[model samples]
Target: MKILKINEEISIKRSVDNGTEEQRVVVKSIIERVRQDGDEALKAFTEKFDGISLVNIAVTEEEKREAYKEIDDDLLAIIQEAASNIRSFHEKQLHPSWMTTDENGTILGQKVTPLDSVGLYVPGGTAAYPSSVLMNVLPAKVAGVERIVITSPPDKKTGKLPAAVLVAAQEAGAEEIYKVGGAQAIAALAYGTETIAPVDKITGPGNIFVALAKREVFGDVDIDMIAGPSEIAVLADDTARPDEVAADLLSQAEHDIFACSVLVTPSEALAKAVAAEVEKQLLTLPRQNIASQSIENFGAIYVTDTMEEAIDTINRLAPEHLEIVTDNPMELLGKIRHAGAIFIGRNSPEPVGDYFAGPNHVLPTNGTARFSSPLNVEDFQKKSSIVFYSEKALKENGEKIAAFARLEGLEAHARAIEIRLRK
Candidate 1:
């Protein structure tokens, strides 16, 4: 990790670029084929990219039962526990449809409705994790979504999804599971095929191809977010432990070579210590090559004159994950303007939120924290405004509405309102 004195202009622009024109072009072609050829395109693409030809795209009940048989009892228990925690957290986010009656007998309210169906895209093969399946699906279930489907790539060797993924999807209350992955899977979800029905929305993280596909198909079907590489920013003071800070930084760096890991501190001594500690820890990581490349390219440690300066830098960066290790981490919470999720104190590391913590781990990345948010139950739900006016209420306000409409040169709209009135 490179260490430097804090500079506002350079620090804010440190994130690596995530776009590639080549990938977008390929994704466009894939989406077009899926939209035109339907099931045939899905089959051919699956064989071409995944190197496995599947007679059936949907995972069967027998396969799900086999997945249970293959999974260990302990792992299944863990998934259940995690799912329970996730369910409890998201259920609190559920809100009922509300209405209010005014003095004039006017009813104004909002009706909350869950999406009819949703598609979840899980990365398959080597990058698959059961936790992601839980994070993406359980929220939709909590939001009262009626149909939840999953699409993941099958393994090249065995031509099957990992048992852990299947078990997690089942536990999360998904209605159907499809053996498809990549941009092709995204396309299939956006525009339904002969076998798979279309969904109202798609949510999950995947490779660059999947991200671009989601971007292209956004208007046709709703999408959660166009996520970039993972990133973390640690705001530490002199009181913070260097070793723990180094470990937290590495947690995100190992995610991708483009992943950004940063440290902002007031103490020069702490910065040097963290830099040294990171080098020491890199020796033990299995993904050291990826982490080292990420650290070398996008990672940095800056020494600020005071905590306020550090906080200012963090706000400008607007990192995906932020860990605050200071004398009083809570004191800085009010000062933070931009961050997807904040981990306060030494005990609350980024991994806790990534796995067992009740919060969603699917967060905005690559400075998107400035405007976007973590995926939540609201993403799977839509709301409609309800307006009802009694005859007396309409009589009271009808003239003002007609006058305003006429001023806008909309005579038809004004006359429509005028018809309800005597004059």
Candidate 2:
């Protein structure tokens, strides 16, 4: 694949960054109809979309315990370690409910509480993503979500979920498992059926159908960000290794044919070297075609005038994953105002965030990082601001409060406070 030349003055538009245009709509409509029609609609979609018979949507207790033994100890250990790292990182993010009493005898603060029930979608189709299983459940578990329900499609060939996925879910503390996928699974999670209970919120990554379903079901249940194709941007200098940067770019590109992998560097020589390294690495990757298409269509090397210029260009992109492989990445951290997550140094690759690293892999994409954030403990929990007033407190500020309410034409609100003060 030829390296696309990016001009320093221009921001290159990815040929494939078409945002939320696909199956999100069709998936959404299917989910709604399934919510209304229940088993009938769900089975039809399951058969049509997934090509699976659906007599039982919920995984049985016996089947779950059996899945544990089916997976070997080595893979199990990896899942356990990943879960531990994820748990430890999210534990630091926990917030406690706090209250304060002011001079006027008024109490005000916020109560941080976890959701009662959360639904996690573990994408299962051609391949199983145990990493996604870890990503979705770990945050909710850390947030103290009471009941975590997991759903993934059964394997088309084996007619069962991959051993790695089931084991990962078990390690992550999912309370229940469902044998469903695509838009139908989303519908069941949102509306509940005889077998599956409705959850308070749904979180995870899926195809365009799942993304669209999440978009359509937003008000009915809380959702994480509408995820796009995985993306990574490596900001490197002449000091950075060309081979490593090329490998990192391909890592995200292989995620999907549309995934965007980019490199922005101040050194033209380094850019050329990395571009050559990308070609060398692609020959060895199993998903070479997918990664090649992604890089050829959406990838590029932007030669900036300086490191400062490179950082400015990256901030505008707000990529899902950002890696700074310059000499001293720490000094450049504050300069980076955007990015869903930042990895500094040559050793800190994007996959570190994907698995063993404590930070979440599920992140905002397509420049949404400027406004949104990676899935964290906070996403599975909510905060309600607390307010309380004593008779003395109300009397102290009653007139002002009443005047403000009156200005807004809320006579009842003014009367309520005024009546309390009068007493």
Candidate 3:
């Protein structure tokens, strides 16, 4: 980790990867093939990309049962408990459809409706992430999405999806699991195939091809976001533990080679201590190669003149994951204006939120935390504005509405109101 003195405004925003022209062209072709060839295209792509021949695109009940058998009883209980916690947390975010009536008999309100269907893409290949399955699927289930589907690549050797991924999806209440991945899976989710029906929205993370495929089918179907690399920033003082801080930073670093882990503090001694600790810990990390490259290229520790300046720098960074590990973390909570998720004190590490802390781990990355948010139940639901004007209310306000419409030079709109008023 490199240590530097903060002299001016700092930004950790990485340039968004929009994919190369060749990748975009390939994604477009894949989507068109799925639309034209349907299930056959899906099978062909699966065989080509995933190295598996699938007699059935969808996972059977027997397969799910076998998956449960593969997972240990203790792990199964843990998954179930995490599911309960996640469900409970998101259930609090639900709001009922509401309306209000005026004395003149006019009614106005917003109707909240869950999406009819949703597709969650779980990344699979070198590794499986059951936590991701829980984070993505449980929110939709909580939001009352009627049909939740999951698509993940199958392991080449076993020709089966990871048992853990399967178990997590089922525990999260998603029964429709498909063994497909990459751009083709995204296409199938966006536009229906013979086996997989189209969804109203798609949510999850994948490789560059998956991201490009999502971008290609965006207007046709809603997507959660174009997520960037993972990021973590720690704002700490002298009281913070150096070893714990270093471990928290490496947790994000091991995710990707581009993942960023930064530390902002006013304590020069703590800064040097954490920098040393990070290097020592990285020597024995399991993903040392990846984490080393990430730390080498994107990791940094900035020494600020004051804690206020440190907070200002963190606000400018607007990191995806932030940890405030000062002596009085709560006192500075209100000063933080931007962060996808804030872990307070040394006890609340970033992975706690990632796995079992009940908050969605799918958060905004790069500088998007400035304006975006973590994946939530609301992302699975849509809003429709309701309007009703009584005869008396229309007569009272129709002329004013017509005038407002005409002010915009929309004659047809004004006539629509005036003709109703004439009646």
**Index of the highest-lDDT prediction:** 3
lDDT score, residue 83, model 1? 91
Put down candidate 1 lDDT per residue, 1-423, tens digits, no spaces: 799887647543442334577878899999999989998999999999889999889998889999999999998998999899988999989899999999999999999999999999998775568999999999999999999999999999877899999999999998599999988899999899998899999999888788888889999999998787888999999999999999999999999888889999999999999999999999999999999999999899988899999999999889999999999999999999999999999999999989887889999877788899999999999999999999989999999999999899999998998898975
lDDT of 3 by residue, 1-423 (tens): 999998665777776568889989999999999999989999999899878889999988999999989999999999999888888898888999999999999999999999999999999975789999999999999899999999998888887888999999988989999988999999999999999999999999998999999998999999999988899999999999999999999999999898999999999999999999999999999999999999999999999999999999999999999999999999999999999999998889998898898989999987988999999999999999999999999999999999999999999999999999877
Off by more than 4 A, model 1:
11-18
**Candidate 2, clashing residue pairs?**
24-212
The CA lDDT at 26 in model 2 is 73
Off by over 4 Å in 2: 1-25
> Which structure is stronger by TM-score: 2 or 3?
3
What value does the lDDT take at residue 323 in candidate 2? 96
Better of 1 and 3 by lDDT: 3
Ranking by lDDT: 3, 1, 2
